[model samples]
Target: MLVFFIAHFVLHWGWLVLNTKKCFRRNKEIKADEIIEAKHTAID
Candidate 1:
């Protein structure tokens, strides 16, 4: 459960961190592909 929470929220947090600047400048436009790509990078 703890690991699940960390994995879920870590990906969410990473996505948020990656898009924070754009979110602040424009709007909450989350590019999920980028998040997925990041996950792939980590997995690799």
Candidate 2:
């Protein structure tokens, strides 16, 4: 029973880390798009 609980906790934490990484990557792409758009607007 103790082993099962430990395995479950480890798996849960690993999943959280993976999710946070994906979220951070998505935010970076969005920020990049915003910068590109601003540059285009400034030139026009």
Candidate 3:
């Protein structure tokens, strides 16, 4: 029972970390695209 609990906790923690990293990277990409669009608009 203890081992099962430990395994569940570890899996949950890893999932949360991975999800956060994915979100952060996606946000960064979106921001970069917005910046690029703004630059193009300024040039035009």
Candidate 4:
């Protein structure tokens, strides 16, 4: 029972960290795309 609780806590924490990293990467990609779009618009 104690082992199960510990495992659950670790898994939950790991999932949260993984999710945060994924979101951060996705946000960076979106920002890059927006910058590119803005530059193209300025050129045109």
Q: What value of lDDT does candidate 1 attain over all alpha carbons? A: 0.80
Candidate numbers sorted by TM-score from highest down: 2, 4, 3, 1
lDDT score, candidate 1, position 10: 94
Candidates' lDDT values, in order? Answer: 0.80, 1.00, 1.00, 1.00
Q: How does candidate 3 score on lDDT?
A: 1.00
- How does candidate 4 score on lDDT? 1.00
Clashing pairs in 4: none
Error of 1 at 19 (Å): 1.0
**Candidate 3's residue-wise lDDT over 10-37, tens digit each?**
9999999999999999999999999999
Between prediction 3 and prediction 4, which has the larger TM-score? Answer: 4
User: How much does each candidate deviate from the true structure in C-alpha RMSD?
Assistant: 16.2, 0.7, 0.8, 0.8
Better of 1 and 3 by TM-score: 3
Error of 1 at 26 (Å): 6.3
TM-score of each predicted structure versus truth: 0.44, 0.90, 0.87, 0.89
lDDT by residue for model 1 (1-44), tens: 99999999999999998798767655433456667789999999
Instruction: TM-score for candidate 1, please give it.
Output: 0.44
Q: Against the true structure, whose TM-score is highest? A: 2
Off by over 4 Å in 3: none
